[model samples]
Target: RKMSALAGRDNDYIFRQLLEYTSFTYTYILADPESKEAILIDPVIEMVNRDIKIIEDMGLNLKYAINTHVHADHVTGTGEIKKKIPSCKSMISKYSNAKADVQLSEGDKIKFGKFELEVRSTPGHTDGCLTYVWHQKNMAFTGDAILIRGCGRTDFQQGNSGRLYDSVHNQIFSLPPNFTLYPAHDYTGQTSTTVEEEKKLNPRLTKTKEEFIKIMKELNLPYPKQIDRAVPANMVCGMFELQDAKK
Candidate 1:
């Protein structure tokens, strides 16, 4: 949805949330209305063309294509988007050990005109997970650290229940209670949640640290079917493997 941002100011920003059905991933496009500069987050490889078309139609200058972490569910579109929009650079966390044009760290700011997203490292689902915060807009893009009513599975990719617990409490929940949180994937139909909602209603996160860890340990979820292919491809930004992946 499109709306005005920054209270008491004459600011108009564009925001669109696109969903990739197969992986249940949410790709976000945020642009500055005045400058027409845009940034895309957590894009899936299969949706590159559609996303690019939207950017083009909107007359936005695609400045950055960013991933919250190295995803295991689907290949990233960052590399492919960069290829089509030569001016757009691919970005990820330096701790992710993934190749990208920009490797971010805590406190790093991704600026597209008057808009900026502050990076906060919140590793739990994976050691490189990052939550991007738009302070002016009072929103946070939470990759997989926290979900609508659940949290990311802490069973693989260096998943640590304790670390994940700390990350959520310290980084995300600490934001203003009114702040909206957008996640990478959601099994349920819900699209977004507020900090206050999760704080009081999240069954898993409401418990003590030790209790949260216990719950994570007993999830007994199945192994990810696509990890074998998705991981290697995602490491290099999902560029060279597109041909083989389609086969």
Candidate 2:
């Protein structure tokens, strides 16, 4: 979709942008038209400059840099954004054990301008995964918890197949069917999917809890390419100052 079409002025004052990075990871920029206040979800460090340019060009006042979870695939841009935009705070789930300006819990609302995102604690992917829902917009930022036709791998990082199944069924599938679900990563060129479609079509979620566990256990997916470096860096909000200093 066109960047301009990604966000626009409306009666509800919602401004949004969906950006894609090399890892098939998606970053979201949401703003309130009236206050011009914005928040970015799941930003990648490699795209920090690009994200900053968009915010500056749009005349937006970024208030928060939020992560859906402590990602294992890529480092976050939260620290870099905070360095560039001092007013913006970095936020992550309290269960993540990651350092950030704000440690959020379930039911916490993240406000930017007039928009408020209700935090739904949907762990089991990594124990700190969260889904941010905007009831008015009928949208949910699902991260890796629930992908297009699949769910996150429950092989490592405190992953539990049973808990993930429960989380999806109870926390996410419980939402309105029309709710548009935006996942953090999509490798097959797919952009978005609706809760209704996922509920009915998601291969991983459609199975019984026992079957799901069996499937997840047998998949044997490969580890992320950057997990070693990414996990450590992300724990500190992608601040590589010490690593850079070593060079």
* lDDT, candidate 2, 1-247, per-residue tens: 3343324645445445455556778999888766778899999998999988988787778899999998989899998998898889999999999889999999999998878999999998988999999987899999999999999988988899999999999999999999999999999988899999998999989999999999999998988898998888888888788446546
Stretches of candidate 2 above 4 Å error?
1-11, 15-17, 242-247
Best-performing candidate as measured by lDDT: 1
Candidate 1 per-residue C-alpha lDDT over 1-247 given as tens digits, one digit per residue, 9 for 90 to 100 = 4423421144578888999999899999998877888999999999999999988877788999999999989999987887889889999999999889999999999999898999999998999999999998999999999999999989989899999999999999999999999999998889999999999999999999999999999999999988988888888888775546766
Off by over 4 Å in 1: 1-11, 241-247
- TM-score to true structure, per model: 0.93, 0.93
In candidate 2, position 232 carries an lDDT of 83
Candidate 1 deviation (Cα RMSD) = 3.7
> In candidate 1, residue 22 scores what lDDT?
92
